[model samples]
Target chain A: MLKVNEQTRQFQSGITIGELANKYKPAADLFILNGFPVAADAAVQDGDSCTLIQKDVIPTPDEIDSFLIARHTPGIQTKIKQSTIAILGLGGLGSAVAGAMAKIGIGKMLLSDYDVVEPSNLNRQHYFIDQIGMLKTDALKANLLRMNPSISLKIIRERLTESLLPGHFSNVDVLIECFDDPVMKAATLRSVLTEMKTVAYVGSSGMAGFGDNNKIHTKMERPGIYIVGDETSEARPGMGLMAPRVGIAAHHQANQALRIILGADKGRK
Target chain B: MNITLNGNNKSIQEISSVLDLLKSLELTPETVVVELNTTIIQPDSYDTTNIAEDDWVEIIRFVGGG
Candidate 1:
């Protein structure tokens, strides 16, 4: 055990991240929402100034950091370093997913969203009013680059069909399903589940509301097939995806991807 | 009973079923994923997926973004 000197924050040795969350519930909620951890072993060095640290205000632990045990956990920066994911939609869920894939340091991303930003999208979509007429794939590209200049992005602006998807899925490790039409989404899922032989995971998302919710449904089929949000969850004009909810789903998808890449048992996740 | 939920330990009533515990997170039946002791519990089965005192659960969300 490390000693916490006068300069140290309150000592919380050997406390699991979650236990600390309970001790500081508000902070914990924030951390969980943001995908941070509550690792109790984290030390505030003597003489170092500190502030209240809410452990949950971040994404899942990608690698074991100083606060959390350092494992090459899949979603930590490491898995993003090791894998490639193909995102199938670039609207509400797709844009959020793409932005997250870059911010979290995923190695490569193939983004496909045939839609264009509309004046209506400004309310919930991440795009700016200035980007209103731009194709979603292009707008997303510009936005993602701003988020992480080093990310490798492959953009496809055309609406994709089953045939178009296969060529892209060629070397992809994971598939993120987020199509606009329910029938198309189902078709894409079925196609990927059948044809993408090398794919280990497929993550789907569906969120349509103003609030950033921590609530969403994610699926991991056959180890690598994962889904986030409800692809079929239709968003009404005022109820389309808000940043927080979309962000939460994006965070979870990245976490699952990192976990799988690390060989960390999905159960361990 | 003490068990882990998303890497943190918490004390739940010894008899709290997996479904009951999920209700505490305020996740809708349509959102949220529940993996109890490594198995992904289907939505229809969650109402009956009784969590053991020693079980480990990972609760994740699927929100829309970007």
Candidate 2:
């Protein structure tokens, strides 16, 4: 028999459950709900007997990069350092994906792209005038470094052919499918599945006059591999992909990646 | 036939190859991917892949937002 409220106090003393999360929003995030250590808003059951918890959001990739290179790189764990990620394209989705990864402090990244900045890209991509006509991999690498100077970056300014991919991609922990081509995305999906057993995340939509990129639905293919902004699989969209739409897809991809790394996404997908 | 995506069906098309169908719908390869009968067909192969009658083809595109 389980005894709840053993150390029970008064008034504010209540057990955590799926319903109570709304009230104790702060502590609700840290409680282990549904058998995983997650935020307080996670669910629980009556008489489950759990403890309250609290957590702090970490700094963005830019800050972590500076810190690691200047101070903490040596101390970070090998499991984390050994974790490698591949970002297929460097357009709207890839740019956002890179920013998210850098902020979350992924140990290493394989940023690959075979495009250059154009005037049209300026309207949506995370690139500036000086970067126009410059290689996307170069520009992204510069920005990524600014985000986290210490990250072990292995950038490939080439298309992700099977040969080029076999080396850098084989040992990666996760692969972010942010490529722009439908063929590339399709070919890429098959490529990742064939190469390593690494968890892969892909961006599916977002490319139009002016679309919102933060609201797309992301799905997990493997328990860990996920695809964000899937316009069809989720029965969500049936329109032309636009800028913000792809951005939303990228955001979902990023959110899931972070959730998985922290062990918070367990069964929550 | 009735269908929904994100939830809406702006236009309808009745055609053969996905490329032709999309062109008839005025959709471009740069903006979307064709989901024919739950299978995703790459834009490069849109010319060769045929869309069967009554096939549920989902054309998805990118829209901008934060």
Candidate 3:
């Protein structure tokens, strides 16, 4: 058997790299066997692995960043770059999560938010002073594109509702629930969990105030359902959503989403 | 009747159905997930599923704010 791009293929006797490509992927111009570039005549043996590199295709600067990213993470980068995550709210958690995902090469992102960036949001959200009056979805999109030009983004400026979620999330791999209102959060979860059973759900709960950083952690609520936060913190008049704790929870959510995409949370569900 | 709601032990009158329990806690059924013992109860069955004494119930709702 030969491992090709992480998939096992039966090794045929008396076959060369050129012959195999001719039969399977006729457009292939380069073959890498066992971590070395091989010629058309190079022989493939059982238990060997192969990678096909497209001919005459040069990676742009953004694509180069993706290459380096995947190069560092080994097996995880491919899945990360193939994932499509829908962030329902582009507030503190959603903004931070989107930025982190873009940095790590998340292939596509769908951001939804109807609210404009407020002056108060600058303290904890990922927004600049000049973006105070702009829609959060637009601002976050601009920031994310600046970070990863290769990212495929779709933005919805309207308020998200159960009726609208299906059209936006029908093909998403993961859903990050980031609404700031308890009612909206509950509503989104209620609809999405029942409608889209296959999509992974990563959410945050009780991530308010400046308290022990250790309290922020990831919890697998059920199969395909993960929550990141203290699981008990609620924002009050005095106890607020600070940057430190909110960022911690957002990182937990982002990390969990990545792990889910990479199948790292497979059996641990 | 006693039940464990969200990992917390609580004593309440026999709430009759899952819908009753949600209403007693001031929660809207559409926005909450109810787990009885270890099985998840469907949202439509909230009014039909009964809550027994000593039942372990998890009333989970989303926390707004990131």
Kindly list the per-residue Cα lDDT of model 1 for residues B1-66, writing each as its tens digit: 888988899888767776788777776654555668866666678777787877898765543334
Full ranking by TM-score? 3, 1, 2
Candidate 1 lDDT over residue span A163-251, tens digit each: 67777776777677666555455556555555665665555556666443544766654455666665444555556656666667666
Worst 10 contiguous positions by lDDT, candidate 2 chain A: A1-10
Question: Could you tell me how far off, in angstroms, the CA of residue B46 lies in candidate 3 after the best superposition?
Answer: 5.9
- List the candidates' TM-scores in order: 0.54, 0.54, 0.73
Cα-based lDDT at residue B11, candidate 3: 82
The TM-score each candidate achieves on chain A is 0.64, 0.62, 0.74
Error of 3 at A141 (Å): 0.7
Lowest lDDT block of 10, candidate 3 chain A? A63-72
**Where in model 2 is the C-alpha error above 4 Å?**
A1-82, A162-164, A206-215, A230-243, A266-269, B1-66
DockQ-best of 2 and 3: 3
lDDT of 3 by residue, A19-131 (tens): 77786657788899889998989998888877766777654655456454645464676677778999988888999999999888788999999999999898899999999
Write one digit per residue (lDDT tens) for candidate 2, span A140-249: 88988776665778788866664466576666666777765654665555545545555544545434433343445665554664556534322123543355555666
- Cα DockQ of the candidate 3 complex: 0.38
| lDDT values for all models | 0.61, 0.59, 0.81
Best by lDDT: 3
